[model samples]
Target chain A: MTKDDLLIIDALQYVNWNRELFEQAREGGVDAIHVTIAYWENFAEVEANIAQWDRHFEECGDLVMPVRQAEDIDAARAAGKTGIILGFQNCSPVEDDLHNVERLHAMGVRIMQLSYNNQSLLATGCYEDDDAGITRFGREAIKEMNRVGMLIDMSHSAEKSTLQAIEYSQRPIAITHANPSSFHEALRNKSDTVLRALAESGGMLGVSLYPFHLRGGSDCKREDFCQMVYDAANLMGVERVGIGSDLCQNWGYETLEWMRSGKWTFRPDYGEGSAANADWPRQPDWFRDSRDFMNIAEGLRETGFSDEEVRKVMGLNWLEFFRDAFAPASSVGA
Target chain B: MTKDDLLIIDALQYVNWNRELFEQAREGGVDAIHVTIAYWENFAEVEANIAQWDRHFEECGDLVMPVRQAEDIDAARAAGKTGIILGFQNCSPVEDDLHNVERLHAMGVRIMQLSYNNQSLLATGCYEDDDAGITRFGREAIKEMNRVGMLIDMSHSAEKSTLQAIEYSQRPIAITHANPSSFHEALRNKSDTVLRALAESGGMLGVSLYPFHLRGGSDCKREDFCQMVYDAANLMGVERVGIGSDLCQNWGYETLEWMRSGKWTFRPDYGEGSAANADWPRQPDWFRDSRDFMNIAEGLRETGFSDEEVRKVMGLNWLEFFRDAFAPASSVGA
Candidate 1:
């Protein structure tokens, strides 16, 4: 791939890891991937998740390299390797103390979502009926994360908490995987106010292809996905927009059943005790039996975004945010 | 006193509570008092402070009645009882979680300081050299305070944190004890930007009688204090001007020494390390031992302000702000 090629960055992806997915990512021209290591796991559980990644690295070490800093992305590109930055979907791993954030930052867990889908001690989740914003503990968590230069992800936070978090986190935060509320007034879609605030706070909004939160809602086509990305870019300039595909490929009925249970689900609304619910098949039929991810790049090309805009939408924007947020803050005061 | 007679609320006071101070408050004809119950205390320690007050209520029950709601101020006035609303000079008691906020509010803690004199997880204290605005934690704390109807006080917060907090807080917070920086440029004084932001947030600026932060420092007369208040009124209308004397009349050298210590002092530069070391005996030599708080009323009259303006400067303004900030928020969404 050329330096000026559309270097897509899958800002978020929860897919089951396999050679097929890695091959698809390469075919799709995704330069880097911010992959999840923790969702509902606590300290030991999240540590175990990281340990599991040790095996993934051993098995697929040629396909991916752990990214602790922004420079690592460029290094990965030079080595022709897919840079994988470890991320978390919740702050439950750190529990409540401020010091744990430092420990996690050292572990290469670079990005963290403050809440999942309901109320935690730190903040309200996206699925919460009341969007009561960030809690005092959550505020403390943000400070700790900011201090250690961790990217704050707010994709699954309550509306009020998200806004407050955007303002509070001095460094840029990310949506990681969310669609525009203007496209579909679903709970998962962010409204224009949120998008505008995120941009103002020097943050980026990663448009997602979650299908469920899409305007078409499960019947979404690749063209529909491109349009959603374009819409976000149109509102916030292309420089501030990117993709967080949120693809959950390779999961079967039994796996889906486990994913739906509270024990497996980070949020309350998505699961129905077991992942085996028939409604779980609401994923669009077109995506089924698709063995490659190259279609995503072609879809963007069809959407008429320039090569540079496409690069940003892929992963460059996320990298820029990571570079700024991950830098250490000195004893600097105003 | 007539209902229409101006009633100035000593919005903040940390006097050594005794029969003398109570009699002084009554003699001063103070309508209501926002009394301190916590400073550098953990959860249990703060509870003890409140418990002490509970006993004080029993011992001198006829002198004062606790004011949980704004309307209670009126009840205290009508019943010929001194209104005592619980307040915190520092927000160290709520610990980390914001759920504790609701508990404190339930216990009648209506006002809280964002920071004392140095940095906490939330905001920087006024005495801190680095004024690095409000922390992510601080921002979240304010939102929770807004939700639970707690008034945010920034009398001892750093400058940038005060400015950012004023902008971020949904409700108008109170600078319960401070002077104008335009007059003295002291650490304890606030700048015009701080005042303007606070005013824009629909908040009140409680100009205090702390002489060290006044124009002439310890040399300021009662007229200088009135002029400073008038200048603030000129900047942020009469409706937003009120009084918050950072008064402490109960203790002597030992109190000052304690305040200067790290346990009580949030900022290292706040005091010279003891009441003995502090530029005592507070107020210039001319005003020393002047027992009459009514001099403030006379000073306001000297400013040639109308009775309405004087009424606001006394306590009406703070009362109005309390009503607005503590009210339930109805609107929700992007």
Candidate 2:
């Protein structure tokens, strides 16, 4: 497929929202983008975030449209606008009640990770000292999410918990943003064991282009990054891999602090980087912001991938995943 | 040691709290008993349960004393009273907050299962269609529980979750009440994999006397029960096995319903037994009430166990477990 005909879905991104960013995504020919709405906010705070997104949808109507279902991507594409899918990086918004899961699903929150950098109520985060896997509440929550057609994301979750979720969830889950530990030993990156399990279970791994998760950090070459994707595709089938450029743009140091040290702890936790450098890490020159997504596709083509394989990795895989994942449990196979 | 000299600790029992039950436990020469305080009640509701327990401790002071540490067992023995160790059969008492773990531990609650017969926030119950293992909240809760000296229990959790708990917990956990599935294939009975894992992790498996978990329900003979223990001892060393009894006395059919269907489910869930038999399952003639505990010791002695082994199966093993499991994390070894 040509770039215009191809479905281009960025499975995850948490960039500071503005008309500029939406225009950039539209300029990049991004058909659908899953946007992070909550990091560590509680129920009410998350509701406020949703309310804010509602305004953004209105203000940027010409540039972006809200995506509540897989078909919405096509709707956005037909309108010549980028589709925005809201997601949460942690389970905090659900609080202590499993009922909140269905409530959030109703409000257009399609994807929610079990945990962020630290442990949450659902599954262990990658930053925990020990990963106890999923909790009793987590099992119930997973069933509820699956039943309600909400996608379970485990990008920041620990290995055992990620594996258990892949096994336990009836529908396939997603690692919406993270690279493989084999390529880069970042704490947030996944292990080969988890990636293999995720692939075998028909789950998707959105290979992250976040600077901190890239080998050689912000200086990583486009060829090297594409080679990583090629290696991941060889390990996990090409259909199970996609792009989730976790590009955090136009956010200040305060946002970085908030992301790492949510109210869970009073002490500053400079996750993925040391405290010596306080600002957000530099973005790689090869992949910066939504506009650089096509660079990855071009790089993949150069790295021995066929045009079809490049298309799948660039966005088609995530579009297929969204088609299957964004439906009610009863309607998924049907 | 003689049966009289052995510290006869029943690792688990949930009886209708009355002076008669306390007297029966005392009559059985039980030194310490881990009593179920909460099943599915939330934090505030569990506090009400604890308040009720406070009254029980006040009224039954001569017959029972609250046990917060291993030293309390000896105190109860000296005073000729059974030490009551408050425990929860589910993690509901902690709700969604990790701080509640320390709060509950301070209130003298020691043993808390990650789930009941259904999924909880912490781990998957055996009744769940799929076991998601432990959740992110469960990981933080386990560490907090470990720090505060509360014991993790997994009697009603699924095999994967139970084994995960065994692997993840810093301190040894307990299967406070459940028999081996090898003895009887009840849904609640554990698999050999879990039993071996429990034993290898220096944990305790309190063999259940609940008829549903027995080989032939209420019709199971004393010799058969003893033989199952002997077989279990061969699989998991004798040091890891002890009596839990799971004795339920003077409870009506409604109580069974409450146990099976906690507040989490609106519909009645007839756990372990059918809805046709709503009342508590009939206990074997050899083991009916707290007073029937010694009968298990006699049965073990008859089934090729030496007197020392019988004492270990009856109570000594639990005493040793409590000795190591009830101290603050820092003081336990150092």
Candidate 3:
């Protein structure tokens, strides 16, 4: 399929949303995007974020539409709009209440990460000193999320928690956005063990384009990234791989601080033990914005991917994963 | 020192308080008691709990007084009242903010556990599948708690986290309510490694009296309990030993459910993995209430402890520990 004919879905992105950005996504032929709705927000704060997204849908109706089901992506594609799938980067939106899992799910949060870059009530994050696989509460939360169709995203979770979540969740889970650490040893990147377990469980991994996760950060070439994808596909079957493109577009330094520190500390916590990464690292020239997603498709094709493989990695795989992932456990026959 | 001459301090207890309970403690000759003020409560909820304690202090003025400093324990002794030392069984009251460590310390919360029975932002609890020692936030929290004179309590923390807290804190930490796991394989009990590390770091281990943490549960005899203490004293120096009791007086099964489940899960979570322990296990007949503390001292004497050693085990060691642990890190001189 030609690049234009391919259904492109940037599985995860937290851009400073506006009409310009939505138009930029459309300019890139992106059919759908999973937009992060919360990092450390509590239930009420998450509701505020959803309200903001509601306004975005109202005002940018021509460019974007809310996505609550797999069919919504098709609708967005037919309407030439970018479908917005609401996701949370932390379980804080549920606060201490497990029932809030279904409550948030009813409010259109289809994906919820068990933790961010720190330990949470649900599971250990990648930045914790040790990895506590999953808590008693996490087990119950996973079952509730699975029952209600809230996809478990473990992109920033520790290795053991990630693997356990994969095994424990009756339905397949997703990493949502992260690269393989074997390519570039970023703390946020997944290990080979985690990747294998993820693929074995029929899960999807949206390979990230975040500079810090890249082999050479911003200086990383498109060919290197595509090669990493090729390597990941070899490790985890091509069917379980997709372009998550953890693209953080148009956010400022303050936004990065908020992402890293949240309300957990009064001082700035530069996660991953790097004092040099205080500022947002530069994005690669090949994938600087939502509009640059096509470059990844081209790079994948150049890296020995067939047209079918390129189409699958670019978006089709995530589309299929989402179709199964977004349904309630009973209906999905998990 | 004779038993009557020694200042008796019960290091931990969560009782459904009333004037009668305060009178019972006074009758037990308890000079001070570290009362659990919060467990899984948020900041506002913790404040409400403090308000309730304030009412208890008002109504039971003849029997109890609030103890904010080590001197207050002596003051309670002089005044013939049981000094109430406020503590938290979980760090949930701090709720992801390091500043809350000092805030709650200023509010008379002298001792705070890094976690309850699950993973928290600060540390991993014993019930988790694995232990992720301390998080980056936990390190900073330890410093703040030390600076502010809030004793770091790791009674329910996982092994790695407990050891890390013992090593990381500028001041010695405390396992405020647990016994040696060698004596009883209960999940809440401490291991030899943890016990040795805690003693090597000049920390205190307040051996628990809760039946579940006892080897024989409710059937434990005074001789067996005293023998366990003697063994622990040999394992860890007698200077670092004391009584935390972990007494849960007058609470019903619903309170037990609240403790294990909290608000984190919709379904029941019988922590430490036994569904048969849904209700509070029966307290040992010899030490069923605060008034029974004299039995422990008598049992220790029977186990071949001298007057001084028995006095130290009963309360004097905890009194000295409180003198140092309740002081600011600078004042304690580490």
DockQ for all models: 0.02, 0.08, 0.62
TM-score of chain A of 2: 0.98
lDDT of 3 at A121: 86
Give the best candidate by DockQ. Answer: 3
Residue-level lDDT of model 1, residues A1-334, one tens digit each, is 2433655567887767777777666555556788877666667778988887778778887777888888888887777667788888877677544567889999879899987664454666666444445654566678778877788999888788899899888777899888898887777779899998998777888877666677676788878878878878888888788777777777675555443332422233343222343544355554432233346556676898876677677777877877776676553230
User: What CAPRI-style quality would you assign to candidate 3?
Assistant: medium
Cα-lDDT of candidate 1: 0.71
Distance from true position, residue B227, model 2, in Å? 6.3
lDDT of 3: 0.89
What is the full ranking by TM-score, best candidate first?
3, 2, 1
Tens digits of per-residue lDDT for model 1 on B1-334?
A: 2333866577877777876667667766776888887766656778998998888788877778888777788887787767898898777777544567778888879999877764554676665444446654465678778777888998888787788788888777888888778877777778888888888878888876666666666678777778878888899888888878767666776565544443422233335224344544466543332135567766787887777778778888877777665554442210
Q: Model 3 segments beyond 4 Å from truth?
A: A1-4, A265-267, B1-4, B272-277
Task: Tell me the TM-score of each prediction against the true structure.
Answer: 0.52, 0.70, 0.94
Give a tens-digit lDDT track for model 2, residues A122-201: 77778766666776567778888998889999999888889989998999999988999999998899999999999998
TM-score of chain A of 3: 0.98
True A-B contacts kept by model 1: 0.00
Candidate lDDT (C-alpha), each: 0.71, 0.85, 0.89
TM-score of only chain B in every candidate structure: 0.90, 0.97, 0.97
TM-scores of chain A, one for each prediction: 0.88, 0.98, 0.98
